[model samples]
Target: MYSSIELENVEPRELEEEAPTLLSVGRELKPEKMRPNVWHYERGEENAYHRQGEQEELYVVLEGTVDVTIERDDERDVITLSKHDVLVVPPESWRQLRAVEESRVLAVGAPNVPDDGMLEE
Candidate 1:
């Protein structure tokens, strides 16, 4: 059996308090090995600084622009991504994303472990 659903049809999930709108694509699609999410950010909205224990994530900017900050070993790097831009982040690297404008992003991560993420203060 196969399943198909349009992105616009899925309801947003309240995964983060006071954060961007999140659509859980993997939850709707039910893929076995990966988790995918679509995030809609208003201007100045941002996610928290966090890292995953075993999941490597790929983020693609679907609309507008965002600034992704990555931290590793006391060093931090900020990367600006526009539409169609992609960023790959390693499992242990902490990352945060802030919207430069109203934007949409597609984030896919492997292994799909729900409890493997850690947030920084």
Candidate 2:
């Protein structure tokens, strides 16, 4: 039988890493085209444009709010994503994200992280 766990002086660690002058999580995500890898996307305070590969992806909101833009051949769709909202991004579509209020999002993709810039838009 599994024993009940007990808390022991647990505390949240203070993050000390400096924010990137130019956000490149979009580029960093290019090579890691796999699922189950958790990425902490710092607030860009601006919109970031990107696209997914052949693999499917799911973006789950962890904190704050964001606006997700999905681009198709004929039309562009924009949706507001807030805490607890899961956004599914299909392959071969142009996507961008804007942190509405210092938000945090989790992106999960299948297979391997696709090569950066798989779509042209």
Which numbered prediction scores highest in TM-score against the true structure?
1
Worst 10 residues of 2 by lDDT: 3-12
Clashes of each: 0, 6
What value does the lDDT take at residue 46 in candidate 2? 38
What CA RMSD would you report for each candidate? 1.3, 7.8
Tens-digit lDDT string for candidate 1 (85-110): 99999999999999999999999999
Alpha-carbon TM-score of each model against the true structure: 0.94, 0.62
lDDT of 1: 0.92
Residue 113 accuracy (lDDT) in model 1: 81
What is the lDDT, from 0 to 100, of the residue 90 in candidate 1?
Answer: 96
lDDT value, residue 17 of candidate 1: 62
- Candidate 1 contains a number of clashing pairs equal to 0
Lowest-scoring 10 consecutive residues by lDDT in candidate 1?
12-21
